[model samples]
Target: MSVAAADPDFATRLNAFDLAALVYEDGIAIDRLMVDFARGLAEAGRRVGGIAQLPPGPATEPGQVDLIDLMTGDIRPLKQRLGPGAASCTLDGSALAAASTGIRRAVAAQVDLVVISKFSKQEIAGGGFRAEFAAAVEAGLPVLTSVKRSQIGGWLAFTGGLGTLLDGRMDILVDWWAETERRRAKTRHRHVS
Candidate 1:
């Protein structure tokens, strides 16, 4: 619940890295990571729930990728945990076609918290915190994001990087929010922190 500032120099650090272009590299894993993140939040407490969007064009990763192993390996098991305070949403069509509408749906559902995980290259390219993501962020959505730190520029990059690239910390976020008394129960309106 603290309004403490995150590492202010994070964006400056991420922009300087010499990472390769992530577009074609491990692209499938990107989507998988996002989906799994949403799932993780859903698993964290008694009232956590999710609204998943399947991106157009076979959102499923390649069969050989062993997604089940990915879900259970290293990362904690999402299905095993359940909290009454989290929810995830998945879009059925192209983001351009459905994301805005989906936002409306969330508005109608009275879900005040939303997290957009940048767990994949595709989503990374989708302008993570721009006119689109920014709309949600501006709306005060609880974005669980993953993005290339370089693009967001300035302090936002580093501070926002967790929402973009480092989603593994979601468990900690869930636990922290719970302890802060922000989430009264799963499915209950969260007190924005």
Candidate 2:
């Protein structure tokens, strides 16, 4: 995967941001990073929600992709077979919509973090997890997702430049989480006062 060059001010930006995207060229490494981040949070007893994807298989066959629901451990297939002669994308839109339920559930449950797999072409075009992303952000949950470098403009427009851009590093992710928790605590304390 094409990881964004590590930004020196990433940690600083994390302190003031709740929405961020790991910008990458390809998806394999980005996927791994997201999974690890969620796993670490779950191990730390933090409530993590949303979906992580298992990349499609070999190039010779039709792609078979599955999305894992972080909160419930459910796997949802994200591709459909459109026949060998079809040159168009085989992504199953219905399956994607169904999988998005996890995001809605996460918002309702008020999870500590929401890890959406990727904000790619579909999301850029106003589909995929766009609404789910909006929901999690609206709920004031810290959100982490990946985006193709080619789609950075779309991501920026969608987030209105309010989201932090992070490299595909576990340490950076950890730093962001710590800062987010600190911010959340401050918000809670202010409300209590």
Candidate 3:
């Protein structure tokens, strides 16, 4: 269900086939939120895949790499300078390759949840982590991501009407996770039987 239509007891009402996306407005600390959520899931013994953006260093340098693969806890650089400017930070193709390698491996190993940091401009253009995202969906893993409100159209088109939009609230996300795990467990039990 979409966040706008979500009930207070949504955690107990979600379907097994639900796929969710976090819709965030600008200025929200989405990357930090993703990292924290993933850490909590990992600590709770969930096998989380995909990547999260690490917090920037104290120096505040531009063009710094910050993507961290959740599966292996590998901190990798995914930023490159586009030109000689102050805010020319762009996605580094090479770094994306390295990070995707880790994600692909995680998908192959069947992680319980996949946390992609964001679906940004590159993803709209059919690049970036698009392939890994498809892999997670095809494998029926619970996928979590953030999307700018402006890019909601692109995100919708990409997911083919299969994603639930969630508000960028921690409580909502926690409920979503609980529902996802419950659905997954049900699926597993059905398969085993």
Candidate 4:
């Protein structure tokens, strides 16, 4: 994956901010970090939208979790139970479809930022939230998402080098959001003038 050097002002130059995958080392709580970051932005009065993953349940059941709708605290299950093991579980495409509907609404509503929980195996394989991601980008909406180190290749190719990889830092994300808002405001002002 091509790592772009952190450019603090990069968001200011673009109408839409397509974030680079937030790469974290093994054992890092990247999911939780993303949840907290999205919450922080919303609490700070930014009109954040899209989905953030809810933490997985206890270890007795791995890979079982729901995604939270950022605008509404609705839960969408990620996998359907088939049996006891990881192999028993299969992705719940219906749930994803429901969530995608919400994302499309969010984009149409022009939310300030869109937080896709992750660019995962499904997305890389041309499934999952890939369509929602494309819709958000097509609408020129700023998007933030986490990408596993292993899946960075697909993420890079999918974003076509337009994404900025962040180091999972809350401050850095906040800076990008601020710059994006600034750019949006400037664009609005220019249109009015």
Best of the candidates, lDDT: 2
Rank candidates by TM-score, best first: 3, 2, 4, 1
Model 1: residues >4 Å from true position, as ranges?
Answer: 1-30, 40-95, 119-129, 149-167, 176-193
Model 1 worst lDDT run, 10 consecutive residues: 15-24
* Tens digits of lDDT, candidate 2, 1-193: 0111133444343432789888787644887788878988899999999999855446524466788889998887787777778888778887787678988898899999888999888787877788888777766778889888888998877765668998778888889888888888998899999
Evaluate model 1: give its lDDT: 0.35
Report residue 117 deviation for candidate 2 (angstroms).
Answer: 0.8
Backbone clash count for every predicted candidate, in the order shown? 41, 0, 0, 2
lDDT for each residue of candidate 3 in 131-193, tens digit (9 for 90 to 100): 887776666667788899999988877765557899998999999888877877888899899
lDDT of 4 by residue, 29-93 (tens): 88788888888878998887888877665752666778888988788777798776556448787
Q: Tell me the lDDT of model 3 at 30.
A: 78
Task: Rank by lDDT, highest first.
Answer: 2, 3, 4, 1
In order of appearance, the predictions have TM-scores of 0.39, 0.83, 0.83, 0.82
lDDT of each structure?
A: 0.35, 0.79, 0.77, 0.75
List the RMSD of every prediction in angstroms.
Answer: 13.7, 6.6, 6.3, 5.2
Q: CA shift at 53, candidate 1, in angstroms?
A: 6.8
